[model samples]
Target: MRDLLGDQVLDLLLERSKDGKGGLRLTGEGSMLGELVKSVLERALEAELSSHLGYGKHDPAGHGTGNSRNGKIGKTVQTGVGPVRLAVPRDRAGTFEPVLVPKRAGRISGGLDDMIISLYAHGMSVRDIQHHLRQIYEVELSHEAISNITDAVLEEVRAWQARPLEAIYPVVFLDAIVVKVRDNHSVQAKPAYLAVGIDTDGEKHVLGIWLAKTPLDHATAGESSRFWSAVMTDLKNRGVRDILIACTDGLAGFEDAIHHAFPHTTVQTCVVHLIRNALRPVARRDRAAVAAELKKIYTAPSAEAAFDALADFTASDWGAKYPQAGRVFEAAWDRFTPFFAFSPAVRKLLYTTNGIESLNYQLRKVTKARGHFPGDDAVVKLLWLAIINIEDKRARERAAHKEKTGKIKNSPSTARLIEGQRTIGWREALIELDIAYPGRIR
Candidate 1:
């Protein structure tokens, strides 16, 4: 090669390539660089083995040692430059473990696994990923191979779910979104419940997700209650010692579950859901009018005044025309009005499950592309990916904003956004809570 280069063969080769075959190709399997990489890797492995044995290959020092060099084991290792055949060094003692490429590793490089996870997290289907690999890298990965790669995240998901949580979340929004999953040999829609907690600093955090399943011999309603109970128990077990208030969409038996799990926690029904339920039985034309009246009740100065507004509405023309709408409001009046006891700032946070609903929207965007997941773990896996992606984006945006603004001199950190929200009327609410249920806050 040096003789040819000295004879100006390098210039001729470059000219021929520029004429037709395109520019230089420096890497990939079977290329000159690929052979060099393989040679270098094998040499490194031999060096590692030499270090482990305290002697070089064919060294006289190895003669008396209990452990000595054994014959090379030639193995085909999958690498970024495609598959390369490597002569892995072995020792008679069999105690040497290669750190560069472990014995069980089929792939010599980590790049492929990282790429597979990135594509899967972005909502690409297994088939789409197979085609992507073929087009981009001339690599054909089987459906089973892609599935195995994504399934590796299950252990991570379990560990994340079981990780410890904050001792106190001032507010938590609980809600469920439906995703289609294959169950009992058929695809069917099932509810996946999630909890989003707002720490005292006010930033939103996803607490966890649970797939709703009715245990055998238990009714749907009973199992639903138990499922929530289990969720609450999981939170407690994970170090969530106190939740000041829980905002929910008012799923039946859920309030009781909250009370059962955390005796002193306040349960506030989402006013948005309450309004939608209130409008369901009303005439289409009366919706605007009734919604206005309902808003008066929820936005009232106090619970007593809110009940007064409800009474006045029931006696009014619109409420009289849609009695069932008023009846629905009357049914869960206490849960519906818990926000009234809170200050306006707290009321804004607790009056709805919009925070968790927004997260569900993001989750749905990722899952909506698939008709149905093969299993529950698949659904959980995708949702976890979506959350990670969304959080990553928000973190980047926050960082950029902080850099541009320089400490937010006139404003606040995203933390302040949460603190300002949950802290408004917080002092009064805490005082009331502590007085009402002594030792709960402590």
Candidate 2:
């Protein structure tokens, strides 16, 4: 029955409702879908967050030093689903600390308000959801109640902006999507920058989030260089030493910053961005052939081969109509060539930004109904809650993969030194120990 209602519904329930003899019941208000979710989720969030603060497992989203001392308090992140919280077993204790599995911000993790707002962003009208709640769970949901949900994320968003991060990542991908915001004066929709990273193991993690200037003109206060610099500094302090690769759509001076911070890393402009950027300059009649030719270049056996293919395809097909397309490829030709050195396995991973793209895709799915986030904290609250979903997905995948392979890797062994550490008088472990290391035994 839990799986039947799905994660989204279950998450809402975990946040706002409590388990009862009669099935799902609201924890606070009259039982109904929206109100119930708002209540139960908020209640569970408070409980979980209280545990974190008491035991010091982590800080709430809005607080910051860019770093902090972690404790052993394990708690669940009650989602709309049931309590989707992680109780880090006490036995494992301090030995196994998870960075990404736990949401980094405290305030974001403090409540369920943003989770409700994200639902609104995802396309559920406030009244529609209110009506749905009344009909299903029989709870009343007011517009202001919904606003309260979104308003919760603002503090978290602010802290997330200043939170410290690891110094090096194997690969980092940067991109953005539009989100609405209300500043001191007026309310307007703005672009929200999304930065995501892939660790050596391939699990994707969120670095932080930022809001862009609205009005659709790329030149506004939305994409500030200072914010990007602070993010870089935080990563450095967190012990990130080498960034092997960076994937981005296209940001002015972002490349320069990457080079200044980590000179050894390779930067690859997203092919999706390149193709989209190049197409704007091509003729409609010739766009199909041009697109096909560009695809061939990226798909070629080697970067040299890709260049050759680009020249030939352009000459016969697009010709003078799309000369700039060829030049665009030329400018980015060096980092693009690494694919030629990769086997099919490595190439598939390097060529696309699918790992990072998934984050934005999830954001769109999660926030479809919300026209604007009340402030930054609202964004962090919803996103921090969503991180739990990502961790759960990763855990399931890792468990399934381990089960399929029958054996685990990287186990430690004491057999090699056991004999040396013991002295045997008879046919005992000490005898083997003596035989293994004759002079070393006492």
Candidate 3:
């Protein structure tokens, strides 16, 4: 590469790098490095045009050749150091294509697009990215240009959303996080539903994300059955034949939605959500006492025993004071008792929607800064970038752990939307799940 620049250009570059104060400036605006890059690229393009025309410039043996240098076109390209202006040699035949710097391309440097995507993934807005590039790289980019770079990933997001899934998921957690989006000339909160499925191997995968078309009602704060049914049908269409246990936060009609798509699946209402709702009406001082009593019902030896515990709690003073607490458990008793049928190890995984909630927590961190998204596509774009960022970070962590320990760690205390890490005690839970549902594990 340096040989292509030749000695004269190299010496000029070095001479230009020195400042009047005896310092060297190799980066930022008007840097010698940018100038060197510009010079090399222009030289390379000229060489390519010469090779295409089958002769050297101004040394043609025949003057009647069909194609010749018509003139030069002025172009500016983005580089890591900064933007560089260049004069690309043109040909009369219009068939000379430059490989070093392709026509109609604004960026010539590799990894610049990926860097912009990484910033967008980490929650930097388009304006933020524009300012960052100008301030740090001394390169100016318009908001539309930055958006165009990030928008390139929308196709990848579509492909990922429509990708095929495993025939069976041992456990799938369903949940949604509300994001404010512009709708009907106003900003409204809309739920972006997500499903995180634990494959037969116990590794987690985010099945897909669906943005609600209409805003959710803040008064009811309930998820729509129609929206979830479409999401579930999308999963079914994508090749999820069965889900052994589906855990949810008791969203409205969530049970029916799951059952409508996968009739045999067991829907387990999230026990933690239940506990939180039951304690909503309790005073702060009495919440601890009330929670201990509520724990007895979920921790009992069997479903019958758990019912007995619930009855006993209803008769106790704390339950008498907070009757609505016991009623909250009774309201969702059918969905809540499915986990009790399994052993403690399996019940631990089935009893809560913590896995999906943790994923929502990470997504919220990415979207929290935005006052409202311009549209559903914008919301999906940002969230999809955030998911890619998360999976990439996890991949690096796993690779580092494997390098240091010579083996990968699989035991995470809670189920996470990580591809390689397995849920702790999943082997034992799988054994129980396999026995509980014959032929479904496959």
Return the number of clashes found in candidate 1.
0
| Pairs of residues clashing in candidate 3 | none
Name the weakest run of 10 consecutive residues (lDDT summed) in model 2.
415-424
Residue-by-residue lDDT tens digits, candidate 1, 209-272: 8887644453332226777787889999999988878888877677777788788788888888
Candidate 1 vs 3: which has more TM-score: 3
Q: Which candidate gets the maximum TM-score versus the true structure?
A: 3
lDDT by residue (tens digit), candidate 3, 249-309: 8777677788899999988889999999999999999999899999999999999999999
Off by over 4 Å in 1: 1-43, 49-98, 102-105, 166-168, 199-204, 216-223, 240-242, 280-289, 315-317, 320-324, 403-405, 408-438
Q: Following a full C-alpha superposition, what root-mean-square deviation does model 3 have from the true structure?
A: 3.3
lDDT of 2 by residue, 226-257 (tens): 55665566667656666766877656666777
Clashes of 3: 0
Q: After superposition, how far is residue 171 of candidate 1 from its true place, in Å?
A: 2.7
Instruction: Give the worst 10-residue stretch by lDDT in candidate 3.
Output: 213-222
Off by over 4 Å in 3: 1-15, 18-26, 57-63, 92-99, 215-222, 404-416
lDDT, residue 261, candidate 2: 73
**Regions of candidate 2 where Cα sits further than 4 Å from its true position:** 1-129, 141-167, 212-219, 280-288, 338-341, 387-442
